[model samples]
Target: MKKVVKFGGSSLANAEQFKKVGNIIRSEEDRRYVIPSAPGRRFSSDTKVTDMLYDCYHQAESGKDFSGTLSNIRERYDEIIRGLDLDLNLDDEFRTIAENFKNKAGIDYAASRGEYLNGRVMAAYLGYEFVDAAEVVAFDENGNFDDRRTDKIMGAKLDSIERAVIPGFYGAKPDGSIKTFSRGGSDITGSLVAKAVHADLYENWTDVSGFLMADPRIINDPVTISTITYREMRELSYMGATVLHEDAVFPLRKEGIPINVRNTNKPEDPGTMVVESTCNKPKFTITGIGGKKGFASITIEKAMMNAEVGFGRKVLEVFEDSGMTFEHTPSGIDTFSVFVNQHEFEPHEQQIIAGLHRNVHPDMIELESDLALIAVVGRGMRRTRGTAGRIFSALAHAHVNVKMIDQGSSELNIIIGVENRDFETAIKAIYDIFVVSQL
Candidate 1:
């Protein structure tokens, strides 16, 4: 029953938070492997250690006296060390960092120090061996993660150690240069470790208890999804539900390992279980409501357009030539609409419009902006009837107009487009019908 536990920055923000994490890990005997992120904000207005390190490195890059900035970062760790009442001395570590900073050791190196230092503290406190992520997690020269090499090396390394703390986020390239995952990448690191060890479960501890059915900002106290499939999670994450890193699902999902999204603040709560598939039924018709705004739709109408063999391909090529990607393309007998990010398309709008006129001559071209796309995703919806009817009814009752609606052939999700201003209202209406009213 080996489990890989990854704690978010908030779980390791300060000494108090660290103590809570320590207790959580000690409580579970099978939680042998640990991954820790840099200290996050102690409070709302406080800065994250990673952000502080980035700022300090930027100052050093500009050839400024960054000693003061570096000292502040040291104090953050010193405060944690004192709170934990550990006999660890970080002065030597700070000296090495200072020398590296003087040598302009890239921003990745500076940012990774947060996890490195925290891993040291975590290892000492838990009486576990400290395994630097750089030594095991491998990234190619081009900064692409080498999953095959990483799994082999990391697995062998952990096989030899009973208990160990592996810092999350940045890994080392072939030349040992530091390379970081994108922001919020510690989640990916944890998934990789889980795959390496073939752990029964991967536990991700964060500030929130788990993924909410709807955005908390839109729907107050929305229900938590007890279990969600990786496919369902991908749909929600693509739209905007961001409890877990979007890329984190790949590794564990491929290996058939389940991920438990738990809360470090409230370990008693089971949170959400993300698995490949589950027989358990969802509590609601729709598993989750997630959406994003700022999209524009381009409608092109042409006579006998459907009769043209390569009409759609020719139309899409214009967008591709302009370096633009279409989000959705819903077509009719003589009309088709292309949805895209408004901000990205704005700069290349005229070019795309001109290209469309040149390649696929149309009777008229219409453009609509400030649109939002919402995804109502759930496996339960497939087994239930009138799901789309319920969504339309809910939106209609709320006086929201749906500009477009598209359901995937799999019937796993229904995407609805609405005016940007109606985004929150639409999500609320949908939530009320499927979740709140049920309660």
Candidate 2:
């Protein structure tokens, strides 16, 4: 039962957090492979090591002295080492990094040092082999991640090692230059490693115990999602739920490796399980609620619009020509509405209106701005009746008006459009009806 366990930055923030992570790992023999992110904030006011590294790198590039910043980074590692009672010294590592910084080794290389150094400390503390991500994770010369290449090499390398720690978030390009993934990329790294090893499960440890039914900022102490399928997760993630990096699921999707979004601090709590498909019914009719704000809808009306050939294409082409991608398009026999980012559409509104008049020649054009889209996603929703009615009932009771409603044929999710002012209230209402009321 091979398992790849990846710890987030907060899980290894300081000595205490590191000790907790160490105990979690040592408690499970199946956790044979490990991944570590950079040191995060120890407290709310504390700056992350990665941010400090970026600042130091910028200073060096601008021809300013960076000794103090580099020293502070070195101290963070020293503090962890001291707290862990390890005999390891990172003086040489610091010196090499300083020299590279002086040479302007690029921001990617500098930012990657946090994870690199933390992996070093974690390996020494756990007595496991340290595998540098640059040696395993692969990227192309263009700095794009090379998944197939990563899989081929990582699979061959990890096959022989019984236990090892690989730093997350960064890798090397074909020319051997450092390239880091975007922020929150450690999740992607963990996903890739799990796929390469074909592990039974990929455990992602973060500060949260599991995925919440709604954003906590909107709903107070939202119910935790016990189980969610890949499709439902993608739908919620696309709408703005951020418990996990949205792209992290791709690598494991084909390999059928389920990911466990666990909490480092609350190890006993059974966190959310994300699977490809599940027969296990969810506790609530809706598995999750997620949404986004700042949208504008362009509504066009013409008699017998559905009977017109190439009408939909013509409408979308106008948006495509303006370089504005529409988020959703709800239509009827005589009318159509295209949703796009308000900021993107505001400038091109006049031009798009003119173009639409010239192309489709609709009777009237109407525009509404400051819209928000909320997605109530769940696989069990397919079997449940009146899901949309309940959502409407809940929102109506909260005095939140729904401007638009769209649902895919799969019946897995319902997309509701509301005013920006009602975004939070809409989410709370949906959560209350589906989860809170059930409890």
Candidate 3:
């Protein structure tokens, strides 16, 4: 069973953290492919190498003296090499980086240096060959990841090498210009590598042992989810559970490759296993509770709305034309409401209101802002009776009024909209009803 192991920035923040990662990788022979992110914070007050690189790049861009910032970044890496006792000197690499920064390489190039530099350190420490991501990963002119081309190249490249360490996050465009995925995109790079190599498992080593049932900030020491299906994970991720990169699951989802979200500091823990499908029953009725704030709702009531053809379409077209996207559109025979990001909808509210009048010509329109949507998602929910009842009961007990509730047809998730002030209270109440009670 081959495994593609990707370590987060925190996992390789310093020489000591590097030692821990080296042991974890060497512990298993199946772990032939290693992906490393740039050094992260060693302490709470420390700045990450990625952030430092960004600052350094900005200084160069503004034609300011960047030598001091660049020197500080060098010291970070040099400290790690010294701690590892590696016979390596990166003076030449720094020189090259200095030249590139002076040449005004784009932000993507600047952002990627963290991963690139770390990969070099990791390779030296592990005595493995360092494979540059730019040579294997591909992006198009539009800067979107070229999946097919990347898989073909990355797969073929790894097949020949017995073991290799590839840097995460940034890839080269067809023209060979550096392009990066969004922040926390190292997760995407790991998924892509797992897909390319057709590894049986992708082990993402980070600070957390696994995904939690609720946000720890709201619920203290929440239960760690042992197993979560891809669909369940995606729902939770979309609703704001960010244990893993939401988009990273796409490539592995198609290949049916499972991901193991293991904690770097605690390697003995199995962490969470993310699969396409699983036979294991969920320990709780709800797999996870995830939600977000800053939403608004638009309700339009037109008599006999269900009888009118394309009424919903006309209403939605207004939002689309105005460059706005609606989250949920719960409807009734005479009315339907469109939920959208309040921040995105505010500037265009007047235009949308006028468009609704001209297009659908509703009898009445109601607008409400400061809403939050919480999703209680689980595959086990399909088999459980009165899951929604239990949720509302918990919320009602907490004196949180529900503004809107929508249960997906698959019974995989129930989305509850509440006043923004009640968001945390509602989640705690639901957690108590489902997870806390069971425990």
Clashing pairs for model 2 are none
Q: Report the C-alpha lDDT of model 3 over 271-350, residue by residue, as the tens digit.
A: 99999999999888989999999999999999999999999999999999999989999998899999999999999999
Instruction: Give the per-residue lDDT digits (tens) of candidate 2, residues 73-139.
Output: 8899999999999999998999899999999899999999999999999999999999999999999
lDDT of each: 0.95, 0.93, 0.94
Off by over 4 Å in 2: none
Mind sharing the TM-score for model 2?
A: 0.97
lDDT of 1 by residue, 1-439 (tens): 9999999999999999999999999998999999999999999999999999999999999999999999999999999999989999999999999999999999999999999999999998899999999999999999999999999999999999999999999899999999999888999999999999999999999999888999989888889999999999999999999999999999998899999999999999999999999999998888999999999999999999999999999999999999899999988999999999999999999999999999999999999999999999999999899999999999999999999999999999999999999999999999999998999
TM-score per candidate: 0.99, 0.97, 0.99
Better of 1 and 2 by lDDT: 1
Residue-pair clashes per candidate:
0, 0, 0
Residue 332: error of model 3 in Å? 1.4
Model 3 residue 377 CA deviation in Å = 0.5
